[model samples]
Target: MEFFKGDKIYNFMGKRLPFLGFSTILVVTSIVLLLTKGVNFGIDFAGGTLVQVKYEKAAPIDKIRDILNKTKEYKNSSITKFGSDDEIIIRVTTSTNSVSSDLSDEIRNVLKGTGNFEIRRVDIVGPKVGGELREKGLMAFVLSLIVIMIYVSFRFEWRFALASILALVHDVTIALGAVSLFGIEVNLDILAAVLTLLGYSLNDTIIVFDRIREGVQTSKESDLSKVVNESVSRTLSRTTLTSLTTFFVVATLYFFGGEIINGFAFTLLVGIIVGTYSSIFIAASFLVQLKFSIEDFRTKEVEKIKKQKEKEKMRAMFEQGTV
Candidate 1:
C-alpha cells in the first residue's frame, strides 16, 4: 500500500515546465469545448415532468421506449427503471415553459395496452423555477470560489492563496469541460458532484501546501524548488491513496449504480482524476512559480514567539495569584 518511501526525495519539480505546458493546453481546450458545446441541461435546470409508474408485472424497458418514441407527443420522453422491475420513472420534457397537470394521466393512457400500470406520482418543474435553480447553482459555485480564496489568502501569503485559487479554477474548468464534451446531462445531482469536487480538490492542495510550508520552515535548503520537490514526494503516497480509494468507489457507482445516478457518478469520476492532478501539478507548479521566501517562514516564527510570550505572561500572573 505504500507507493513511496518515507525518505525519498522525488524531483517532482524538475519537469514542472512540461507538465505546466500540458495543463495549459488542456485548460484551453476545455474552455473552448465548453463555449462551443455547452453541457446538456436536465429537468433540474430545465423544466420537465417526471411520471413514476408501477406495472402489475415486470416492465419491458425497450418496448416502453419504443412505444414512447412512436408517439409524436411523447417522442422525446426518456424512461428508466427506478425501484423494482415493476416500477419505472419517466421524464418528459415540456414543449413550453409550463407543465400539464394531467401529464401522468396522459402517459397512462398512452401505455394502456402495454401493461396494467398505475401512476405512482408526478413531479412538475416550471421553466422559471428551473432557471432560478440554474442561477442559484452558478451563484453557489462563484461564491464558494470567492470564499475559498479569501480563506487561503489569510492562511498563507497572497501568492500561495492566489496559486491555490487558480488550481481550484483549473480543476473546475476542466471538469465542466469534460461534462460538456461528453454531453452529460447536467442536473441538481451533477451540480452537487461539482461542488463536492471543489472541496476534494481544495483538500488535496492544502495538504501539499502545508507540507511545503513546513519543509521551507524546517529544512536548511534555501532553494524553494528543492523544498517543493521534497514536500510533494513526502505527501505523494497519501494523495495517491486517497485519490485511488475514492476513484474506485465512484467507478463502481458509475458502472453499477444504474442509470438514475449515471451522470452524478461520471462527474465525480472525472473530478477525482482532474482534481488529484491539479492538486499536484497545477497547484504545486504555481507554488514553484511563486517562489517561497524564507520571510514567509519568519512570519510564522514571529506569531509563535508572541504566543509563547503570552503563555509565559499568563503563567507568571497565575503563579503570583493575580491571574
Candidate 2:
C-alpha cells in the first residue's frame, strides 16, 4: 500500500530549482504554440453534420469507410462504430455551400446492401451555434480562473493565488500544445476534459498551498522556502497516489473507450501528468521568488481582529457620547 517511505520525503527539495526551471521552459514553449497555431476545434465548435446508421449485423469501420470513400461527397468523412457494433456514426464535413443531394444518395446506397439500416438520426450544427459555443467555452474557462484566484488569495496570499493561476495556465497550454503537435481533434468531449483538468490541477496546487499555509502558521520562524519544501514533501505521496489512480482510469478509457472517447481520454491522460508536474515543480517553486513570511500570516489575522475590536469600541464610544 505504501508507495514511498519516510527518508525519501526530504530528497526532492534539493533539486527543486532546476526541475522548476525546466518545467518553465516547457510551459513557455507550449504557450507560444497555443497562441499561434491554436487548437483543432472539432464538430462541436466548428459545426458539422452528424449522421447515425444501424446495420442488421455488426459492421467493421474500414468496410463502412471504403463505401463512403467511393463517392467524392464523403471525402472528408469520419466513420466509427457507435455504442453497439451494429451501429455507426458517420460524420461528413458539411458547409452551407457544401450540402448536396449526391452525398445523401450515396450514403443511402451504401447502407442498402449492408443491412436494413435507415437514417437513424441527422443533426446539423450551424456556424453561428459553433461560434457561440466557442465564446462560451472561453468565458467559462476565464471565469473559473478568476474565481480560483479570488479564493486562493483570500485563503492564503496573493502570491499563492498568482502562482496557482500560473500553474493552471501552464497545464492548459501544454495540453493544447499536445493537441496541436499531435493533430488531436478538439471536440466538446475534449473541452470537458480541459475543464476537468483545470479543476484537478487547481486541487493539487491548493493541497500544497494549504500545507504551506499550515506550516507558516505553525512554524513562525522557519524559512519560507524550507517551509514550502516541507509542505511539498508532506503531500508528495498523496499527489503521486492520486495521479497514478487517475492515470490508470484514463489509460483504460483510452485503450477501450472506442474511437469516440479516444481523443477525450488522451487529452485527460496528458493533462493529468502535466498538471501534476506543474502543481509540484512550477507552483511550489514560485514561493521561493515571492516575499513570503510567517509574520505576514500572523500580522494579517491579528490586524483584522484588531480592526474589528477597534470598530466595536468606537461604536460603544459613539453610543455613550450620544447619551
Candidate 3:
C-alpha cells in the first residue's frame, strides 16, 4: 500500500538548516534549564517518607495541612491530592532512609484530627539509599546510550549510526528540559518513559535511513539531496500517521491518567514530536554533512549498485518507448 502516489518529491533536506538551528537552540535551552532550575526528583530518589491516606469523605487538604503544621517533624512536609479528593499523598524529606514506627505514628496521629481517615500505606527511604538509587538511575541511562551506539553502529555504518545517536540525544535532552522546566517529578516511571522513547526515536530514524539506502542502490540519481527528498516523501505518510495516533493516546493519558502518570505521559508526548522531527531533519542532515556517497561501500557493491541504477533507468526508458 502506497500512502504517497505519483513522483512528487519534497525538499526535506533542503530546509534542514533551519530545523537544525531550531533544534540546537532548544537543546541548549534545555541544558541550561537543567543546570539552573533542575528537575523535581520524587521521594523515590530523593530519600523521603511517603504517607498515603484515604478518607470516607473528600480529604480536607487545608485543614490537614494546618493540623500537620502543629508538629515539627511533618511541618515541612508536602501534601498532594491523589486519584480523588478523598485520597491524599504526603511526602516528608528524611535524613535517614530507615522506616521508623514513631514517624508513621506521628504522621497518622497528626492527620487524625482532620477527621476519620485510614492510613493506606507508609514508605520511607534514607539519604544513602536515595543517593545510590539516583546514581544507578543515571548509570542506567548512560549505559543505554552506550548500548545504542553499539547496536546502531552494527546496523549501519558509523556515519549513519552517529547521526541516529545525535538525534536521540536531541530528543532526550529536550524532553528532560521540559521536565525540569515544568518541575515534573523524576522517578523510576519517568526514567522508563525516557528509555522507551529512545527505541521509538531510533526506530523512526532507521526507517528513513533504510529508505535512503534503497534509493541509493536503485535510483539513477547522483544528487544526494533529491534521493533523500524522495526517500523521506515516500515514508512521510507512515511517520505522520504513527506519530499522530500515538500522540492522541498519550495525550489522553496526560489529561486523564491522573497526576501519578502525568510526568511519564509528558515525557512520551514531547518525545514523539521531537523524535519525529529529529529523525527527519537532524538525522538526515547529519548524514548529508558526513558526505555520504557511493564510497561507503567497496568496489563490488558500488559497481553492483551502478548496474542496478542502469537497469532501473532502462526499465523506465522502455516504458516511455524512448529506447
Best by TM-score: 3
Residue 302 CA error for candidate 1 (Å)? 4.7
Candidate 3 regions exceeding 4 Å error are: 1-6, 95-99, 102-105, 296-300, 303-323
- Whole-model lDDT, model 3: 0.85
> lDDT score, residue 319, model 1?
100
Task: For candidate 1, write residues 1-323 as lDDT tens digits.
Answer: 77989898888788899998998988999999988887788877997877888898999888899988998767878897774799998888874534446777678778887889889788777778999999999999999999999999888778889899889888888888999998888999999999999999999999999998888778888888888888888888999999999999999999999777888998999999998988777798887787757666677778999999999999999999998
> Considering lDDT, where higher is better, how would the candidates rank from best to worst?
1, 3, 2
TM-score of 3: 0.86
- lDDT-wise, the better of 1 and 3 is 1
Ranking by TM-score: 3, 1, 2
TM-score of each: 0.83, 0.79, 0.86
> lDDT tens string, model 2, 3-51?
6664454645567779877877887788777788777777778887778
Regions of model 1 farther than 4 Å from truth: 52-91, 95-99, 113-121, 295-323
